[model samples]
Target: MNALTGVLRYLGNYAISSVWRLGYGARLFLLTLLYSGESFKRFQLVLKELYSIGVLSLVIIMVSGLFVGFVLGLQGYNTLEKYGSEQALGILVALSLVRELGPVVTALLFAGRAGTAITAEIGLMKATEQLSAMEMMAVEPVARVVAPRFWAGVISMPLLAALFSTMGVFGGYIVGVVLIGVDEGSFWSQMQSSVDFHEDILNGVIKSFVFAVAVTAIALLEGYDSKPTAEGVSRATTRTVVTSSLMVLFLDFILTSLMFTS
Candidate 1:
């Protein structure tokens, strides 16, 4: 009886805490958006953050995209050849990357790379009372610090996803056409014929955009809410990665179901 009561109490506390955090995060997101005008007023602030988060993440995104495409090409060829449908491998790789893997993988990588960096940087600033200093000086930290980063992530995500998809298609072509001897004409033609611009490509762009919002928001929230200490900053950075990854996967499923299911 005591154990059961204790378990119920723990569950209630957890539920309440989750709800409170969710509410707090929603409020923070709204405030960031409300204060976002300052980010554009000083466009250089956003441009700086764009370089830090987006440009810095390019190498990893491209390399991972290429390797993912290579694997898809190889595995897709092997599977298709068994059924005498080898030429269809191009469509397979292209569709998979454009529809599913591209945005999801890119967002996951962005979370681990740029997302953690944002969280840690903000967390450290908080630890050093920079945010407090800004508040004292009559500056809105959300406008100057948070809003620029938010806009940067939102703008960078879809572009990065597009670049990732492009590199993936190129990698797939190299593996499928050059190495595997799939007919280059048939590969390109089939891929072009089968992929619909609005259905596949646009949906992928939308997914990446959604992921960008979720990831950046979560990272910012974690940092802003972090305890002002060294260990707290570290923990907030770790949470940024884990939370963003889970959000991407969850949102992917929801978006896929809505977009693909009849």
Candidate 2:
């Protein structure tokens, strides 16, 4: 009886805690929206953040995209060769990268790399009482700090995803046409014919944009709500990566279903 009672109490507390956190997240999101107007006024800060988040992330995204495409070309060539459809390798690689892997993988990488950095930076600011100092100075930290980072992330995600897809196509070309001796004409032609700009490409951009908002929001909110301590900031940074990755995967599935469902 005591165990059963304890179990029920624990579940109730867990449910309440989850609800409270959700409410906090929603409130933070609203505050971010309120401060978003100030982002343009701090355009230089936004540009700086864009360079930190987007330009610094380009090498990893490009290298990963290329390797993924090369592997896909090799694997697709093998699989299609079995069915005597090796010429379809281009379509296979392009569709895989643009429709699914491009945005999803790039967002995941961004979460691990940039999202954790954002969380840690904000968390450290809180730990050092910098945010409090800003408040004392009558400076809105949300406008000066969080809003620009948020907008920069939202702007960067789509461009990074597009670059990833483009590099993947190039890598696929190298592997399929140059290395494996697939017909170059069939490779480009089939890929061009099969990949719809509106359906596949546009949906991919939408997915990346949605993922950007989710990932950036989680990163900033975790830091904002963290305890003002070294351990707290460390924990928040870790949570940024784990939570952002999970949200990206979950949102990707929902967005893909909505966009692809007939």
Candidate 1: TM-score?
Answer: 0.98
Model 2 superposed RMSD (Cα): 0.9
What tens-digit string does per-residue lDDT give for candidate 1 at 1-262?
A: 9999999999999999999999999999999999998789999999999999999999999999999989999999999999999999889999999999999999999999999999999999999999999999999999989999999999999999999999999999999999989999999999999999999999999999999999999999999999899999999999999999999999999999999888
Taking every candidate in turn, the Cα RMSD to the unseen true structure, in Å, is 0.9, 0.9
Give the lDDT of residue 134 in candidate 2.
99
- Candidate 1 lDDT score relative to the true structure: 0.95
The TM-scores of all predictions, comma-separated, are 0.98, 0.98
Question: On a 0 to 100 scale, what is the lDDT of residue 203 in model 1?
Answer: 95
lDDT of 1 at 252: 99
Residue-pair clashes per candidate: 0, 0
Error of 1 at 130 (Å): 0.4
